[model samples]
Target: MKEESQTIRTKLAKIRFFSPEGFFVCAAIITVIFVAMEALGLRSSVAVLAGASPGAGAPATLGMACLYLLGYLAFVVLAPIFVMGSIFLLLVNLITGIFRRQQRHF
Candidate 1:
């Protein structure tokens, strides 16, 4: 029981959502979805946001278009920013730790 609990804790600790790798993976997945939506011509449907409602034939198209737009903004515009921010934070932490250790020795 003790060993299993320790393993679970380690696994949980390894799950870092704000890490650079995690951000990149999330960005890549969102990009793929955005590209797929664009390939299917959902871009035109998204223009409904400008000043038009989806027609009676497909009410769901409006919802899908909105979702695609949100995904595009999130993945394309925000993901890289998050990735860079995480990297910067990690580097700062590393440098600070090194400085602290050096100070401790001096």
Candidate 2:
């Protein structure tokens, strides 16, 4: 059990997510979606959340509102996390590689 805990899990660490490339992709996708929704005037549709409608199909308005809200949340939350994670992972990998290379020469 002790040895198992001490052993590094290289497979999990090798996952492509949260890498510099992945983060940039994630942030770009999220920003695109948020901008698209904003450009479509979806923010006004979110008034459905307050039980107010533009006197049209209530279901459609509600759906658009929910989508906008979700996109907004993702933009506000996940985008920053991905950006920070990518930067941190890149720096850590760079520093570690430098250290390992020096140690190998020594």
Candidate 3:
């Protein structure tokens, strides 16, 4: 029972997202997505009024445009910001952990 408990604890301790490196890797992935979206020129596809509307398929176009806009915003802005915040949180956790360990040692 004690060995099982120790193994469980060790597995939990090794979880990747608990560390700063994991957050940095996630941020890099989000940055790549943002760049890809910008390069694809899909960002401006959401401008509904900038071009003449289709005579019969306006609704379909509008729906697709909204979807594209949502995806663009998600990958271009929200995902990167969320990843950056995660990285910041990871850094804070690391710094506090270091300080707490030093305090315990002293």
Best by lDDT: 2
- Mind sharing the TM-score for model 3? 0.54
In the predicted model 1, the residue pairs found to clash are: none
Writing each residue's lDDT as its tens digit, candidate 1 over 1-106 gives 9999999878756857776556655666677887888888777877566657545236587787778888778877877787777688688879999999999999
Q: lDDT tens string, model 3, 1-106?
A: 9999999878756758645555555566666765676676645655665775443247766775676666666676766676777778877988999999999999
How does model 2 score by TM-score? 0.78
Off by over 4 Å in 1: 1-13, 50-57
In candidate 3 the C-alpha lDDT for residue 54 amounts to 47
lDDT of 1: 0.74
Task: Summing lDDT over every window of 10 consecutive residues in candidate 2, give the lowest-scoring window.
Answer: 6-15
Residue pairs in collision within model 2: none
- Winner on lDDT (2 vs 3): 2
Candidate 1 root-mean-square deviation in Å: 5.8
Q: Pick by TM-score: which candidate is best?
A: 2
Give the distance in Å from residue 74's predicted Cα in candidate 1 to where it truly belongs.
0.9
- Least lDDT summed over 10 consecutive residues: which range in candidate 3? 48-57
* lDDT at residue 83 of model 1 (Cα atoms): 71
